[model samples]
Target: MPAITVSRRQALLGTATVAAAAALSGLPPSRTLARAPFAAAQAPYYYRFAHGKMQATVVSDGILPLGDPSGTFLGTSKEEIGKMLTDNFLSTASVVLEQNILVLNTGDRLVLFDTGMGSSQLFGPTPGKMLANLKAAGIDPKDIDAVVATHAHCDHVWGIMSDDGSRNFPNAQIYISQADFDYWTDEAKLAIKEPAFMNAFIAGARKNLLPNRDRLVFVKDGQEFLPGIQAISAPGHTVGHTIYMITSDGKTLAAIGDLTHHQVLLLEKPRIEFAFDTDPKQSANTRVRILDMLAANRIPLIAYHFPWPGVGHVAKQGDGFRYYPTPLQMVLDQKG
Candidate 1:
């Protein structure tokens, strides 16, 4: 039999004709597809994974909308900051940071790292969702054995209590650096009033820390306050901003409280100082030092204000470093 082949012109015309016919017939109706109403809300913002011997849960306190990148992140030209954000596919108009609150369920106790903005209207209403998220993750606030704060910054420590000065983690013992505890809660800070936001920060610190004075364990550098948890002093972001290293079995994860706020801005340009830092220059230096160590050793870290459930590793890039967020382990990753 002779071969019968369709020419390129014929094939193109046939596809166009079929497409036109389908378009003219209008939308198709399925015989069995279920019609459902739109779901306006998202599922719980909590991620759980096994970290060696510890069961780790990363919960969202909520979003923190920092107004204008220029006012928040400084020590660099506004143009540079905007360009950095733009290149990373981030918003240049404002900085919206996530509060990735870490909870560790070691065999014996439940330890929470950095409480989110509790009733703080400091940055508005997007935050203060920590309690709700903890509930969603089936974690009882009262059952928290220890509350470790990276610093006494508003977003990190404001959620420690209610406006009425009630303890949020009533039964849990609190751990914070003595420097931050003293510096933030000091009445004297109210006197050195250059930045307007300093008052609220000082006030909030006093309100929350004063009441819990007895339960507050001033964290010591390299001290093991809780099982498998050790504090590393990383100052300058605040006077006492600390980083925690969690060791389980033979594995470790660093809970870097606020070492770097924006992954792109700070990681890409480590010298760019944050406006809120007690000493911006020192913060930048400390950031470089710690990041260099983490990058050299290939240690994984969870940044508190990075994207939600911020678990990642850093690599030395040009003058700074690059953050590579690890995929969320949705299921138990058991080794063969």
Candidate 2:
């Protein structure tokens, strides 16, 4: 008989088959012979949920990592904040807030609430991914019917336009309180504020708001800005800082924009002021009032500055309130 002529491929195939069979038979398996590169990209950060008859999507605008909660949040001692953060198992060195932007589809119209930080690196470079995340959610900017800003802050209104000054949501009508619009964007107010900080805030506001002045719809408290979307004026964070009451088929969710910055720092100590608030005392009043109502009624809210996909409930605990983030519904329910 001729000597067996097994090619290198045949020999490798035979060895693989034996290893597979041995593994299936409960034998020890071979280890990986080569190294593999780790994953560099992340999955899409958008989360979608049922909103009564409509649909809601929470898209990541990345994160706003404010350095040192003690300085950014005041009306409380540094020691107090440090202890609170440590107790809660949160990072005590810095305060990181998620830019969880909300978008709604009311069948008749598509609405986007509070555009995230556009390209401004004033708070560092982590944020400004709203457009990318929005697209990842299968939403096209031109398809949005309304772009509502809870206030005129850079994190909220700056994303209205691209860096080149073109409308990011070209077809969508803009909605924002005239007070915030005028206050933040006014060149006159810039003179009084410290240029180091307020300059970019005002400049970004003007770059994103002034060009759309002719098309901007001034938001009125208690009025329905769009179908199923009502504006609720929750001031103090700014002159016209507002929160929105989104309702559909009897179900409602409060979109509290900057009403509270941190769950442990602000919510648990509702009176403690955030350094970013234009009027700390007034903001504390508003925070307590809105948080109190939400707690009593067990209403759910989406905090723009809360953890990612900030859909949760607030409950009165001890002297203040406690936040409970709802477990995300990764799959569609029977209704969907």
**TM-score per candidate, in order?**
0.89, 0.90
lDDT of 1 by residue, 1-336 (tens): 223345766788887777776667773432244799999999889998888889899999999999899998888899999899999898888899999999999989999998988877778878999999999999999999999999998888888897765788999899999999989989988876788888988988888888888899988999998888999999998988999999998888999988999899999999988889999999999999999999999889999999877999999999999999988676777541
lDDT of 2 at 125: 86
Those runs of model 1 whose alpha carbons end farther than 4 Å from true positions after fitting are 1-35
Provide the global lDDT of candidate 2 against the true structure: 0.88
- Where does candidate 2 stray beyond 4 Å? 1-36, 334-336
User: Which one wins on TM-score?
Assistant: 2
Clashing pairs in 2: none
